[model samples]
Target: MKNSNLFKITLLFSAITLSISTANASKIDNDEFTSLQYLDKVTTDAFVEENKNKEFYDVIVGIEDDQLATALLTNDRMRKALEVGESFMYKGQEYVKTEHLLNVADQFRQDIKSMLGYDFHVVQTFNDIYQVLVTTDGSEEKEDVLKNLIQTGKFTYVQENEQMQLMGYDNEGDNKPMSVVNPSITNDRHYAEQVYFARQVDGYEGAASIEVAKQILSDRGVFASENKVNVHVLDGGMVPHEDLDYAEAVDFKYRNHQGKATDDGVIWVKKDFTREDDQYVSPAFDCSGFSSDPESENATSWRPDPPPEDEADEWYRYDTNKGLSLNSLHGLQAAGIIAAKSGNGVGISGIIPQENVNLVSALVVDKCSGGSADIMKAVYWSIDNLESPYAIGNSSYDGLPYERTQYPADVINMSFGGGNAMCFKRSNNYWTTAWTQVVQDADEKGTVLISSAGNETTTTFNVSPAGCENVMSVGAIYENGRPTGFTNFGDSIDVMAMGSKVWSTSGEVVDAGEFDVGYGPVNGTSFSGPIVAGLAGLLKLADDNLTPKQVVDLIKNGAKPLDVGFSGGETTCGWLGCGAGAVNFENSVRILLDGEILGEPKATHYLADHKQKDDSNYISLQSEFNPNLCSTYKVYGSVMNDKYEDLEYTLYGQVGSGDYEVVKVTNNSNFTFNKEHDNYQLSACNATTGNCSRNVNVELDSSYSPAACG
Candidate 1:
C-alpha cells in the first residue's frame, strides 16, 4: 500500500490504543476526586513504561471529569485572551502533556460514537479541537452535545459542522431535502460580479459574463430582475453607483484591518474628475495612485524596469516577463467560472447563476507588489465581514510561511502550493510544519481545505499541506479532459477539474480603465480548486447529511472517468493523483437523489435508540437495559390500528418481562404506542377493517413489526 493509505490504517489503531481504560469511574465517589493524583502518577508511570518499550501506540490516560476537566475546558481568563486577540501567545502550548490525557480525548470521542451509533464518524483532530461528524441520522442528541460543549466551555463556539455550514435548508431553516428550480424564474441579483482576464478600460464599464449568468437562471425558470453581480473598484473608498446597463452596480464599504466597522469609504474615479459620470472615469494604464512613482529610480514591481533598452534588457525581459501578471490572470479565471452570468453576448454561464453565492475581494498584494503579514490580516478581514450566504474563498497565491493557527471558513480553496515534504525520512522545516499544522487544525474545526497540485515546467515536489492526507488536493484538466501540461501530479491530489483556459473575475473595476480587457482565459490547477469548492458548496446545499469524507467519496465516485492512456494503460492505479477522475456535476446530483447519499445503516435498532442527552445541542444516550438474546421480556402499551384511533389490547407475544419469550420496555408511558413485539404483522380484513397478525420474521429482526394503518 502507498504511504497515505498506510497512514490512515495506522491512525485507526493509534486511536484504539488511546482508549484502554485503567480504572472504573464508579470507584471515585467524591467530586473532590482524590484518586486523580494517584491516577495522574499511574498515567505518568505508564507513559514511562511505554517509552522504555518504545511502544508509541500502547500508552493511555486515566480521566476524571471533575474540576480539572472543567479547568482544562473553561478557564475564564484564558477564554478571554482567546476571545480577544491573544491566541498567538499560546502558539506552542499544549493543554495536557500526559499521555493519558491524549487518550482521554480519544476515549471521550469514542463515547460519543457509542451513543450516537454508526452514522456519526470522527473525521479529524488537532491538539484540542475535535471534529465529530454526523449525517441524516439527525437525532436530537447530536444537537444536545453541540450546545453542551459550548455551555460547558469545551469549545468556544460551535457553528454548523463544515459539511452543513451555510448549506441551503427549508424555508424555516430546518434540515430537509433541497429542491432544484429552473434558473429562469429565480431572482437575478448578485452581491459582486467578477471579470476574468481583465484588461484596461476607460471606466468600470466592461463586458462581463454576469449577463450570461442571468440568462442561464432565466432559462432554468428563475427570474433574475435586479443586478445580482455587484462590480466595484476598491483603492481607498466605497464607490457608490446606481445604474448598470450590462451587469450590476456595486456599493463599496470600508472597515479596519481587524474588520471593525469604519467610516472611511470612497468611489474610485478619474484622476481629475469630481462628478460620478460613468464616462468621466479615466481609462489610462498609468501607475499614479502609488506614493512611489512607477518610473522612479527605485520602483518595485514584480520585475525590474525595462533595463537600459538593449540586448541585455531583451534577455532580462525574456528571463523574467515584466508585468505578465499570472496571479491576476489566475484569480480572474476562477471568478468567471463561478459567477459570470450568461446572455450579455459574452462569456459562459457559471454554476451558481442565481446570485445565491457572493464573492469578496480583499487585496493581499499591494500595488507596489509587496506581500506582508497584511495578507493574513486580509484573510481575517474577509472572515469577519463577507456577508454572502455562502462564501467560497479561493486563493491562487501561496508561499512564505505561517504559524499553525485556526483559519475559519466553510471552505478554503488553495490553487498555489509547492514547498517542503512532510516525512520522517526527509528533513523537516519549521515553516513547513507550521503550515501543515494550519491545514490540520482548520480541517479539525470542520473546514474543507482544498488545494491545487502546483504546476511544473518540468517537475518539482508536491505542496506540503496538499500532500497531507486530510486535505482535498486537486489538479488541472484541459478542455479535452486530459491532465494539463503544466499541472502537478501527486498521490495526495484528491481530484481533477477543468483549469486550463478557465475564465473568472477581475479585481479591477470599469472605471480603472482596464474593464473590457479584464474578461478572458487563464489556466492552472489554482482555478480547479475553486471549481471544486463551488461544487462542494452545492453538494452541501443538496444534502446536509454528508460527512466530509462521504462528500469527498461522493465527488470521487461521481467523477466522469477519462481515458487513462497517457501515463500508461495502467487504468486502475496510475490515476491516484487525479483522484477518482474529473468532477461530474450532473451525475453527482443524480447519485444524491438515488439515495446513495444516506449514511451507513445501523446494525441494530437496539443500538440506535439508546441515547444520553444534556441540555446542550448535541444529545447523548445510554442503553436502557443489557442487550441479551433468548431472554424473555414483556412490553406493555396501547396499540394503534390502521385507522387513526387507539385500539384495545392486541395479540402480541407472551407477557414474561425478562425471560426468553418476552421483552420489557420501561420508558413507555400509558399513552405510548407498543410497536415492539416478537411476532406482529398487519392483515387487511374484509373491506372495512384490518386485523393484527403475527409472523415468524419478527424473531429474526426487530424491524419486522406490524405496520400502522392510516
Candidate 2:
C-alpha cells in the first residue's frame, strides 16, 4: 500500500478511539474545582499538551483600553504567549508568526479561575486582543460563562463563533421522485422529451449535428480544455455521483497536508474560537473523534437528522418525484448543473461541456445547517489554501450563518437567497443572515459574484448578496421564455435564465444506505444560479483575461431581452431589475468569441425628402426604403471591440435580384448607402489578419420602413 494508504489505515484505528457520547450536557468533573497556575507554564510543549487535552478554556477578549494589552502581558492571570516565530500554511493560509500577537503590554493579573471561576489559556493573541481557550469540568452553562466574561470591564466583548448553512432543503421523511427530461434516458415511463434551451437559439437549434468545443470555440483552433476549471463548492458532504468527478471532490476539513508518516487527520474540532489542539492524530489532538462520520471515508456518511428541530428552516418543504437522497441533495444538484460530465451518451450536457468545470468541495455544511465560523474558514481556505486556486465559487445556501469573511474568488455563484431571515437569538442581526460585506469585498477583488434573484416572487433588491451592489443577480424564466412566477424580480437583477424544471445529474435516493447515480429535473433559482456560473466559466475560458465587469457586461448584453408582465412592462430606465430577459448561451459565447457583432446591421434611408438620422427615433428597410421606391440611404454597422485593437468594418448591401456589394470598408462613420437595396449585412474583420466576423443581417420593424430619423 502507498504511504497515504498507511496514513488512512492509521487514521481508521485512531478514529475508533474517539466518539461522541449522547450525554445531555457538557461533561462536568465531579472533583473539586481546582485551578492550575497560569505563570507555572512558560514552555511550549506543555502548552501544546494542555491544548490537545482540551484542559484549557478558549475565550476571545477585546480590550477597550489600549494600555490593557501592555498591562495583560505583565499580569500573571492567563498563560503567557507561545510567540510562534515562523510562518506556516494552515488550512491553506500562511499564518506568519511575526504577525501573530505582537502588541501585548500586560497579562491579566487576575487568574480567570480566581476572578471568573473559568479556566483560561491563550490559543492566539493579536496585539491587545486575545483568543483564549476556556475549559471547566462542564458544570456551568456556556451562556452563564459568557455572561460573566462580559461583566468584567477588562474585556470589551465576549467571544462567540458562527457557521453557514446549505441553501437547499433538508429532509428525510420521504423523497418522492422528480421528473427528468433527457434525450439519452429511455425505457422510463417517467421520462419525457426534454425541451432544451439550446434548441431555441437561431444557429444552435437548427444545427444538424452536436459538435462541442468546435461549436463553442467556432473554428478558433484551440480545443477547449476537456478538463474543467475547478471552483470552490461549499456545502454538505460530497456524494461521488457518476456525473461528478470523484477525483476532484475534496474534504478540506479532513485533508492531511503534513508529509508522509504523519497522521494529521482529526475526528472533529469543536466550533470554538480557539487553537486548543493543532495535533489531531497524536494523543495530543483534542477531538471527540469517530462519534459522527465527518472522518469517514465516504464524505456523505454524516447525513442530516431525519427531522431537524428548527421548523422555521423550510429546507424540508420542497421535494419531487425524482427520488433524491435529501442528504446533500441541493449541493449535488447545483454542482451537477454547473459541471456534470457532459455528452458521455448517458446524461444531458452542462453549460460548460464535459467536466470542464471541476468542483472542489469546501465542505462547509457539516450536517443540517452550517455554522458561520466554518463558512468563513472554508472561504479563506479556498481562496488562500487550495492546491489549485479556484476560478469560480458556488454557494447554494440561504438564510444566515455567521461572520463576514472576504471570498476573493474569480466568479462566485449564489443560488440560494432569502428576503430577510434574521436570527433573533444571535447578537448579529441582518449581518448574520448574509455575507453582505464579503461580497462587496469580493467585488473589489474582481470576483464576479452571480446570485439568484430568489424564488419568493418578490423584489430581489432586498435579498442579500443579490441586493448587494456589483453582484449580477439573475431571475428565472420558463422554457417558453416567460418569467416564472416564483422568481424574484426587480430593477436590481442583472439578467434572467431558464430555471423551471431544468435537468441535470443527481443522486437517486434508495432505501439502501447510499444513493444510486441518476439524473433529474429541479426547479427554483438555485439551479438557475449554476447556469449563470457555468456561463461565467465559458466566458473566462474564451478570454482568460476577462474581468468581472467585462464578463457581466457580456452576459447581460447577450441576454435575449424579455418583458415581465407582473412588474408592468419595460421601464424607461431599461428593463427593471429583471434585466435583458432570458440568457442565450450561444449569444453569450458569441459575444465572447466574436466580440459582440453578430448583431443585426441597421440602415438609415436618406430619402429624397433629405431625411436625417437622430437618436430620438429611427427607420429601417421594408418600412421606409422600399426597393420599388428607393432613395439614397446611409448604412451603419456596429461591432464591439477593444479600441486599441486594429479592426476593419464592412457594410454589405443586396439589391433586388442582385448580389450583395461592399458599400464601404473600414469606415468609422456612417456610409451614404444610396442604392435600391433589398437587404443589408455588417462585417467586422481583423485589419491585419484578414479574418472577418460572422455576417449579421440587420433586423427591421415591419410597420416602420427604413427612413432617416428626424
Candidate 3:
C-alpha cells in the first residue's frame, strides 16, 4: 500500500518550483524528535562543501500520523493521471493514492532541497516512512539538513541511517581437528560434535534434547514432514550447500539507481539487484582464483589449486585458504542449525527436520556489516511476501511491478543485533521507534521474532531489536549449564541455549590444509537463537493457531533452570540475569503433546520419635517434597499418625487450592492416640504451572523405634 503511493508520486511529478525559508526553523518542539541526544552535529562548514559532490548520506524520515491519511486518499484527477485501479490490496492491506498528498510531499521535498542545495532521492518507502539518500551537491551541512526536515512539523522524526553487525563469533581458533570424530551420539556424521543435543556433556545437563524431542514426536505419530512452517533467516546471504534446503533466497545487498527526475524535480530511481540470468552465486569465499566472484579467472597464476577429494567420502573440500572471502556464511550456518537436511547421510542434523520447514533466506547483510535501511527493507519484504489472506496483488517498485511470494514465514530468526542501539521509547531515538514499529507489525501477524541477546557479555540494556518489547531474546549457555561468559545477560533475555563451540555448516571450506569439510564450529548467541527458533517452528507445526506470545510462553514454561553452582562450586546465576532457564526441546514437546509435565513430583516420607515434656514418647511422621525444573510442587492431603485410635486427632493443613505450600507435620509433633499406628496419605501438585502430580501413600518402617526421634 505504501509502495503504491510512492510509485504514484514518482510518475506524476515531473517538475516543481523550490522555495527556501528558515522561518519555520524554531518549530521543532516535539520532545520525541527533539530529544535525540545521540546525533552529533557537524561543526565544520568547510568540510560540508569539501565533500559536497563526493558523498551521499541516507536519512530516514518518519511521516506524521495526520499526514498518512491524506496521503492514502485517491482523487478523481489523480486516479486518471495514474491510469490504475481506484483501490486495491497490497500485502493484505488496501490503499488509495491521492494527488493532494503527493503535492504536499513533493512541496516539502522541494523546500528541503532548496534549503540544502543538495539532491534528495526517495530510495525506499514503507508505512508512510521514507528513506531518502541526500547527495552532497548542496552547500548545507548534513546536520542542518536533518534539523530543517524535522522543523517542518510534517515529519515525525528524521535521523541518519546506522549500521548493524552479525552477532556470531567465528571461533576458528578453538576448532577441532577434522580427523576427530565421536560415534556415540547418532548415525549422523557430525551428531556427536553437535553437543547441544546431548543429554549430558562434560558433567553438565544443559542440552536442548533435540533428538529426544524428535523421537517423542515420532512415537506420538507426528512425523516431521507433517510440519508445514516457514522460517525466514534475516542475515548474510546463504550459500548453496547440499546440507540446506531453501524455498526462496533473495539478496538485498545492492540496489541500482538509474538517475531519473520526478515531477518534484527530485531524482529517484533505485531498483533492487537481481541475480544474473537467475543463476545462484555462492556468497562464500571463492577458492578458484581467490576472488569474491568464483567465476573470475586469476589475474596471476599463483593461486593455489582446490583441495583434493577425501578418499573415504569421495568429495572435494574447496580450499578456503586460496580465495578472497566475500562474507561470512552467517545466514547459511544459522539456516543449517534451524533446518538442514536430515537423514540424508550428510552433515549434522538441524533442530527441525528439513522436510518439516520451508527455509526462506532474506540476505540483508553484505560482508560482515549491514545498513539499517537494508535491514528494514528486508523486514518489510519478509512480511509482505508471506501467504496473505486475500488474493495477492501486484505492487510497483521503481516503475517495475511484481507479484508477492505465496510462502509465509511463521518464524523469523534474526541472529544479529546492534549492541550500541537502544530499542526503548524513553531513549527518544528514531532507530528505536523504527525497530519497535516493525516488531509490533510482525507481532500483529502472529509471527514469532527471535534475536540473539548479543555477545558483549554485559547486559542487553542497550541492544536493538533484542531489547524491543514482544521480541524473544535468547542468551548463550555452556555445556556445563552455566551462562556463557560472552553472552549478554539481564532481565531482557527470555531463555538460554547452547552456544559454546556449536558445530554447524560453515560457509568457507574448513580444514583446507588437512582435509576438506564444509562443517565446523562457531561460538555466539547467534547460533543459540536459532535453536529456540527451530523449536518454535516445531511448536507451530503442533498448533498453527499459537500466537507469538503463546509460543514464547511454551518455551519458557518448559525450560529447565540452570545449574548455577552445581557440586557446591562458587559459580552462580541469578534468575533475572540468566533468563527463564535453558530451553529443553524434549520437555517442551511433551508439554504440547500432553496437558501437563511428563513426570510426577518427587516426594519422600520418614518416621521419627519425639520425647514429650512429661518424658512420654510419641511417633512423628514427616513428608518432604522436592520441586522439579519445570515446576514447583505443593503437597496435599491429611496425615493421620494413628488412623485407628486418633480418628478425631489429625495433623492436616491445606494451603489455598493450587497454592505453592510446603506440607509437613504441624510443630513436628502430633498427640499420639496410638503410637503403633503411623500411616499417612498425601499427594503433590505443580504449584507454579497448576499441573497436579500423582498421590502417594507412605508407612513408617516397621523396624523403626521411638528412640530414633531424640
Candidate 4:
C-alpha cells in the first residue's frame, strides 16, 4: 500500500511541474510580457537603489487587473515576501468597487501587517491602479520593502511619484506690470494689449484669426455658445477673479491649516466678504480647527501667502510677505487666455469671447510645484466626471464641493511639464508608464491633451508630457512670429503661438482692498499652451463629435508657416523642429467648416531702376482696401515716387474674366475706388516709369473676409 501511494504522489508532482512550465513558456512568448521582462531586467535594480534612503516615498502601483490587486492584498504568499514593521500611516481617500475586497478588508490589513509590520492604506484608487504612501518604523529599508512588493508579481509596475514644473517665465528685465494699451477690434479695456489678437508685421497670424473664424461660424448659424465645450486647466489654485468665469474650481491643496477664530465667534475668511445682519460678514472658514485670537477679532480676513521656504513653513493661515499674492497667477493667466469673459467691457477678451466655453480649474499644483500622483488623480477624475450637462451629480471627491458642468474636459490644458526624453517606450520606468497610461486614457476618452513644450530652449525630445504621445506640445513665438529665445523646440512640438508679452488677467493682490483681481503681461510657453487649448475648445464647440486626432490634425494642417526657422534666419520651420508652424485659428476653422482653404489677401511692391529714367524715378502706387466692409468696400490708393511730385496714376479693375476698366484717374497722390464686384483685381500704374503696382485679388463672401487687403 505504501509503494502505491508513493507512485501516485510522484505522478501528481510531475503534473504540477508541467503546468508551471507551460505558463512560463506562454508568458515568454508574449511580446508585451517579454517587453515587461526586459524592462524589469534593466530598471528595477536602479530604481530601488535610487530611492532607498528617502524619509518616505509615495509610490504609484499599477495593477494589470482589479481582481489581481484584491487577490494580492489577501494572498498568504505575498504576506511572507517581506518582514513586518511596527507602525505606519496612510492618508488620502480611496475609491474601490469590489465588494469582495471590502468583506476581506480585515484580512488584507492583517496580511499587510505581516508583510511590512506597518499599517497599509490605499491613498487613492484608479480603475485597477492605486497609490500608497509607505512608511516603516522597523529595521527593513523602505526601498527593500518596495523591491519585495515588486517581486511579488502582483503589480504591473511600481515607481516613485515625480513632480512637474510650470512652463512659464518672466522676460529678463521686463517683469514690470503691463501698462501699454494697444487697441484691438474688441471694446474690452485690455483688448489692444493682447498682441496675439492681431497679425504681426512679420506676417505671423496671431490668435486674432479666431475672430474671423467666429464670424464664419456665426454666418453659418452655428454659434459656439450653443454647443458649449468644457476645458480643464490643470494647474495651481484659482482664486476668485472678476475676468474669468469658472464652470468649476477645485482646491486640491492639503487641508492642514487651522482656522482662525476669536472669542466673539468671528472666523477667518479667505474669500470675498459680504454684508449680513447689518454688519460686514465674511464667509465661514473651512479649516481643521479654530484658535482663539482676540487680536484678530476686528480683522476677519485672510490674505494670500507666498510659497513656503521649508517644511516647517508649509502650514500657514495668512500672508507673511504683505506683498502681491502670486498664488494663482499662472493658472488665472492661463484661464484668462482660454475663456475670460468677453464683450462685457471687462479687462480683456479670451480666445472665445462668449460664455460658451466652460473653464474648470483643477488645482493640482501647490504654489508652483505638483507631484505626478496628484496630477494623475486630477486627470482621471476629470475623465470619469464627464457627464451630461443637465445631469446633477456630486463632482466633489477630495472633500471639496465642485459643481458638475456640461461635461468633463473636451480638452485639458497642462501648461506645465518636466523630465527629459520621451515618456513612453524609452525607459519603461514606473513613472513613465503611469504618465503614458494617463495620456493614452485621456485620448481614448476623446479629450485632447495640450502642454507647453517647456522654456528650456533646447530639444523638446527631453521634455514631457510634451514628448509623450497623444499630447499636442506648444512652443512660444514673439509678436513678430519668430521662435522665442527660451521656447523649447523639436519633433515633440505640435504648434507655436504668441507667448512674449501676452497680456491677460493677473492673479496678484497688490493690497488687501484688491482681493482677487489684477492684469499684466507674462512670457513663456505656458501662455502659448492655453492659446492652442482655447482653439481646441473652439474646435469642439464647432463640432461636438470631432475626435481628438481629428482636432489635432486640423490644427496642424491649418497652421501657417512661422516668420523664421527654429534656429533663426532659416526662412521656415522644419516639421520636426517647430511643428506645423504657427496656429491659425481662422484657417483651421475654415478648413473644418468649408473643407477648403480661403487664402489671405496679399500685395507686393518694390522699387526698380528704369532704363528711360536717368534719376531712377520709380513710382509705386499702393492701394489699401477694407475687405471686411462688404457691399460698401472702397480701395484708397497712395502713390510714392523717388523724384516725381503729385504723380498722375490710373487705377484699373477687372471683374472675373472681363477686360480692365478705369476705376479712377487722379493727378493727386491719393485716390479712392468703390468695389462693385464680388471678385475683382485692382492695380495702379503711372506713365512716368511705365511701372504698374502688383495686382491684388479681392474675394468677398458671407463668411470669407480678410479684414484688410493691400
Candidate 5:
C-alpha cells in the first residue's frame, strides 16, 4: 500500500513539473512567443478602438515608473548589445536607440523596447523619464491594439494619441486625473521673490539680437543687475560640461533662456524675436545659424555677423539702428504681449502694464533644419542657471513636435497650431502625450500653462497645445466683443480674450518706420494667450498668494459673457461655444478681493421648443414662474455687463404652440414693465392704481404674470 501511494505521488509531481515547463517555455523560449508578440497587436487594437471615428496628429507614450527609468539608464550590457542604428524587437514592440545616445539611453530604450516595442523612440535620456514616441500607424485596428498595450500591467502608463496630449484636453480615457488645486490651502502666489534670468550669447555671432531686447527692457525699467530682475545675458554656449556646471551654479527659483549656442561657441539665429525688417534680437543670448554672413541686403541674409572678440558690451548695440532682420514674427509678437508698455502709440500693449521683465532668451532653432534642438538647450540652460523665485516663460512659436523631456516652465505660452498632419501623414497623438507630460510636470512643480485655441476656421478641429487638459486654452474675441471668425471652437476651449486686431510694438517694423508705438494687426489665439498671461501676472501682483489654478479659476469665473454668439455668431453654437464667455478684468479683480461664490444659473424655463425664424427674432415660452408674485427676481439667462450691451428679448404671449400673441414691454426693468397682451386675455396694469386701459386678463401674468392679474 505504501509503494502504491509513493508511485501516485511521483506521478502527480511529474505532471506538475511538466505543466510548469510548458508554460515557461511558451513564454520565454518558444518561437511564437505569443504572449509578448500579442502585446503590440493588442496595443494597436486598443488604440484604434479608443479613437474610433476620431482624428489625431500623433501618439505619445509615458515612460515607466522611476524604478524602470533607473534600471534602463544604468544598464551597461544593454548599451553594449545595441548596434549603432539597428532596430530591434522586444516583447511585441520595436525600438532603436539613436547611436549618438546609445551610451546614455541604450539600456532604457532596450528594456522598453523589449517590453513595449522597437517603434518607440527616446526623447530625453538624461532625466529618469524615458519618453518613447510610439509610431501611430493611423489605423483604427492599430490604435486599439496600442490602447490595450498601454492599459496592460506591463507598461506603467501609455498615451495612445499625442495630439490629445498637446492640446491638453483629456478624453474620458486619460488615466491621469488632474488634482484640483484648492486655493484656500495655498498662500503666496509669487513663491520666489528673488530669481535670476540668464541668456547664452554665442560669442561674436548674435550681438544685435541680444542687445535690442536688453535695451528695450532697460528702457522699460528692468536692468541686468542682481537687485533688479537679475538679467544675465551670456554671449556664449554653455555646453555639455559647462552646461551641467551652470546648472549647479545658480540657486534658481525661476529662469528665462534665449538663443541657442552651438558647441563651437558660435551665435546663431536658431530662434529670436524679429522686427519688421527681419532683424533678429534676443532678450538674452543669440546663436549662430548654419551659415554666417555679413549683414547684407540679400534675401537669404539670416547669417549672423561675427562681432569683435572680447568686446562684450561694445558689440551690444543699444541704438535701434542695428538689429538682425529675420522673417519670423512669432518670438517678437510673444515678447510684445508679455511686457509691452501701453500708451506708447506703438504696436499693441503687452499683458503687463510695465515692461520690467527679465527675459531669459535662447535661440533653439537650427538654421539648416529649423528643428527645435536649440530651444531644448535653452530650456536646459534656464533650469540650471536661473535663480528667480517664480519663472514664467513664453513660447510663441509652434508647429514643432511635442518633446516631454524639454523644459517645464512654470508658465509657458504656446500660440501657434494647425498644420496638415494628414497631408504630412502624421498622427498628432504622440504630440498630445508629450504635451500631457508637460502639463503634468507643471502641476507637479506648481506651474501654470496657457495656450491659444488656434485659428483654424475652415476645419472644425481644435488646435494643439490648446486641446491638452491642465492648460488654459484661450480663444480670440475682437475688441468689439465679437469672436474672431478664425478662432477655433470646441469644448476644449477654456476662455476668450481680445485677440483680434490688437495693437502693440512692431519691433523692427517700428524701428524702421516712424512709429515708436509699434502697433500692428494681429489675430488668432496666439494673441489671446499673452492677454491671459498678462492677466495672470497682474493677479500675482495683486495678491501674490494665489495658486496657479486659483488664479485661473478666478480669471475664468469672474469674466463676463458676451452677448450674441461667441465673438458675434462666429461659432456654430455661438453663445454656447464661448467658454465661460469673455474675460472681465474688473469683475475678476472684485471676485478675488471679495471671495464670493456664485451658484450656477438656474435652468431656462421654456414654454415650448421650436426652430428660429430669423437672427433677431426667436420663439417665446409662457411664463413658467410668476415674477410679480414677489417684489422682483433677477432674470439671469443672459445679462451683459458694463463691457457690453444686454440683448433685448421680445416677450410674446402665445395661446398655444402655434398661435402668436406679441407683447411689447419697457426695456428698463427685469419685469418687462407695461407689456400688453396681444389676445387681450392678459394685460399690463399699474400695481398702485386700479386704472386699466384695454390691458387686463385673469389668465395673464399679474403685473407680468397670471398671479399678478388675479
Candidate 6:
C-alpha cells in the first residue's frame, strides 16, 4: 500500500504512448482477504508452500517503457506462458522467435526462483509490459501479490486477467425463416431480393441503386475478384462453413493467452486456404511460423444430450474448438454476411455477391468475448499476413482498434458496442488505450473505422468505440421499414441498414463444418454494420484511393432519411439524432462512382459547427444542404431565386431541447450574436425542391438576442 512514487508512475504512463491501459481494474472481495497474512512470511516460505500446490495463476505485469518492455522480454520472472509460442504482438511488433524467447524464458524463471523464491514464467510480452503465470502460497491472494508489487513503483499497473463472452443471441425471428430456401434467393444472379438492403434502398430516391452499381461496374469491366479485397473477421475461428468460401485464418488462441483458452501453442491451418503448391498460393493465410488450431468440430454433428439432469456443466466438443468450447458459430454467421458463396444455389446470398472476397479469419475472441490485448495481437498478425494493397476488417464485436499495427487497415467494421467498461475510458486516456488509439492511427492511415450505434435503445455516446471520434457508426432498421426496436441512435450513428430478420448462412448448420450449406435469419446493428462494411469493400474495390473523409461523406449524404425512431415517433434530425438515416446501398455506390459529377451539398461550406463565438464580430454562415435546380446552380439572366424561403431551418439551442424556427439559409447564414447566448441550433431545407439538411445545434462562445440574428 506504500505507493510513494504513484505520481511519478502516473506521469510516466501518460508520457509513453504505447497505448496501454493502467487502470486499477480488478475487484476483490473479503473472502480473498486472508491471503495478505502470507505477505509477511519469508519469501522462501511463500514460494515453497505455493509451489507445493503446483497451480499457477495467469498474471498481468505493467512496466514503464520500451526499455522495460525489452528487459521484460528477457526477464526470468516471465516464462513463455504456453508450451509452444503462439504469435505475439506487442506495441505493434511480432515476437515469433520461440527458441530464443523460450530459452531466455527458462533463464528468467530460474533467476526469479533463486532471487525471490518465486516460481514463475512468462506467458506474454508487449513493448511496455509482459505476462507471467506464478504460483502463490494460500496465505497470499494473487491480487494481493500484484498489488504489493505495484507499490514497489517499478510498474505502472497490475491486475488479475479478465475473461470475455461471445456477443450473440438467438433472434427467434419469423420474418426470414431458416427452413425455407428458394433457388432465386440462393442464386448469385438473382439473390439480391433475399438480402434486405442489397436490393432497393428506401431512403435514397433511386430505387435502382444496387442494380445501377452492378451495371456501371460491369460496364467498366470491374468484376468480383477474391484476389481484390482483404476482410479480416476477428472472432471465433471461421468453422467449416459451406456458404463461406475463400477464408484464411490465424488462430489467436494459446500463445500469451495461455490458460484462458485451449492453448496447444499452435495456430491451425487448412490445405485449400494455405495452398503453396497451387499457382495462386493465396497470400491470405499466415505462414510466418504461425499455424492454426487443430481444427473445429461441426456443431451440427454434436447434438447435446436431452438431460440437464445428467450433467452440471455447459460445454460442447470440437477438434479445433479445444474440446468443449464456444466454437465458431457467431464468427461464421458474420462471415456469411460479408462473403458467402454466390450462384451456387445452395444457400443465402452475401452482400458482395459474385465477388469472391478474401476473408482472413483471426480467432481473436474465443466464444463471444475477449480482451483488448488478444485483439491487438490478431490485428498485428492481419497487418503482416494480409497486406496486399492493404485491406479492411470486420469486428462483429466491440474493442478498440490497435493504434499502430505493423500493417495498414483500410476499413475496420466494429458491429458491436455498449457503455464504457473497465477496459476503456477517456479519464484513462481512452485515446491512449491501445484499443482506441489504434483506430485513430488507422484513420490517419486512411483506414475508415465503422462501428455500431449499439442495441441499447439509447444514445450511442453511452458506447465506447462507436462514440469515439471519426467512426462511421451504424444503427438498424426492421424489415417493415421501422427503426429496429433496440437500436441505439444519436448523432454518433452515421447510417442505418436492414438488421431485423435478414437471412444468411448459419455456421452451425454444416455437419462437418464444411461450406455451401446452412442458412438462417438474424437481427442486430451487428448485421447492419457489416452490410456497410461490404459496401465499403465495394467502394475500395471500385476505387482504392477513396480517403476516409470521403467515405464518411458518401455514406452519410447518400442515405435515405428514416424520419422516425424505434419508438414509432418522428426523429429530430440533429446532433442527438439518428444521423443522415438508413443506408442507401445502391445510392452509396453510385455516389462513390459519380464522385464530383453529382455536386452534392458540402459540409465544408457550412463551417462553424464548432465555431467559437467569443471573439467574432459576426459568426460565419450557418450550414445548409441544397439540391440544385439544375446540375449546377441554375442561372436565369444571372439572377438566382431565393427559393430557400419555402423551407426554413429550425434552430435548437443550448438547452438541448425545444426548437427555434430559423430563416431559410440560402448559401450561408451569418448572424452577429452576444457571446452570452452563443449556444443555439440551426437547420435548413428546400422543401419545394425536396432537399434538406438535418438540424444542427451549435454552442457559440456565449449567448444571443433576437435582434442579433437579423
Best by lDDT: 4
- Model 5: runs farther than 4 Å from truth? 1-61, 65-67, 74-123, 131-264, 267-327, 342-348, 355-411, 418-432, 458-462, 507-518, 563-576, 594-710
Residues 1-710, candidate 3: write the lDDT tens digits: 12221211011110110111122222332443222111111111111222233445556667665564344222111222342224434344664444455555555546655765554445445454455555544344656666776666656677656556788865536565332223445456877788777653333545777877887777655663466788988886657778887887655442201111111111211111223575423323222222111112321111223323432222223222111112457787888899887767878888877777788887665443565655766676677732211112434432222234455679999988775443566544432456767788888878899999988877786787788788899999877678877889888888999887788887453321121328877889999999899999988887788889878877886777663465755444664487778888876765555433322222222223223412333222221221221122222212211112212212222333443333343221132222222334333332333433233343323343334333
- Cα-based TM-score, every candidate: 0.39, 0.54, 0.62, 0.59, 0.44, 0.56
Ranking by lDDT: 4, 3, 2, 6, 5, 1
For model 2, the superposed segments whose C-alpha errors exceed 4 Å read 1-196, 201-214, 222-228, 252-326, 385-410, 418-437, 440-447, 509-513, 564-576, 598-639, 643-683, 686-710
lDDT of 1 by residue, 322-419 (tens): 11221223334444555455444343445544354443333232221221122222222223321111001211011111122232245555444434
Runs of candidate 3 exceeding 4 Å displacement: 1-51, 54-56, 65-102, 110-120, 134-152, 177-185, 200-206, 255-326, 385-395, 398-403, 427-432, 507-517, 567-572, 597-710
Candidate 6 displacement at residue 132 in angstroms = 7.2
Residue-wise lDDT of candidate 6 within 546-648, one digit each (tens)?
Answer: 7777777777766776675457667544334667766665556544443211222211112223354333334322212222201111111101112224544
Error of 6 at 700 (Å): 19
- Give the Å error, residue 279, model 2: 40
Per-residue lDDT of 49 in model 1: 22
lDDT of 4 by residue, 88-151 (tens): 1112223232434443544554555587564444444444446554444435554566676665
Q: Cα deviation in Å at residue 518, candidate 5?
A: 4.3
RMSD of 3: 15.4
After the best TM-score superposition of candidate 3, give how far the Cα of residue 479 lies from its true spot, in angstroms.
Answer: 1.5
Scored by CA lDDT, what does every candidate get?
A: 0.34, 0.47, 0.55, 0.56, 0.35, 0.46
- State the displacement of the C-alpha of residue 514, model 6, in Å, after optimal TM-score superposition: 9.2
Tens-place lDDT per residue, model 5, 486-558, is 7676667677776654433332322211112233445556666766665565555454445677767877775
Which window of ten consecutive residues has the lowest lDDT sum in model 6? 9-18
Which digits, one per residue and each the tens of the lDDT, describe model 2 over residues 1-710? Answer: 22221111111211122122223223323231112232222322223233333323234455556545432331111223223343333223333333223323213534455786554544333223344445544455555666777666656556433223333422212334423233443332222323443334421221111223226564663334453444555554466676666323333222211000112222212221222364222112122232223322222222223334553222232111111223356667777766666546566555554535546554444333333333433444444421211111211111111122233345656555534421111453212222443454455555667777777677777665466567788777666566666777887778777676666676554311135667767777766777777777776666657777778877776666555343665532144456766666666665555444744655554442344332224334433545433455554433354532556667777887688888776534245554545777777766554555787785432233333422
TM-score of 2: 0.54
Model 6 TM-score, 2 decimals = 0.56
Cα error, residue 529 of model 5, in Å, equals: 1.3
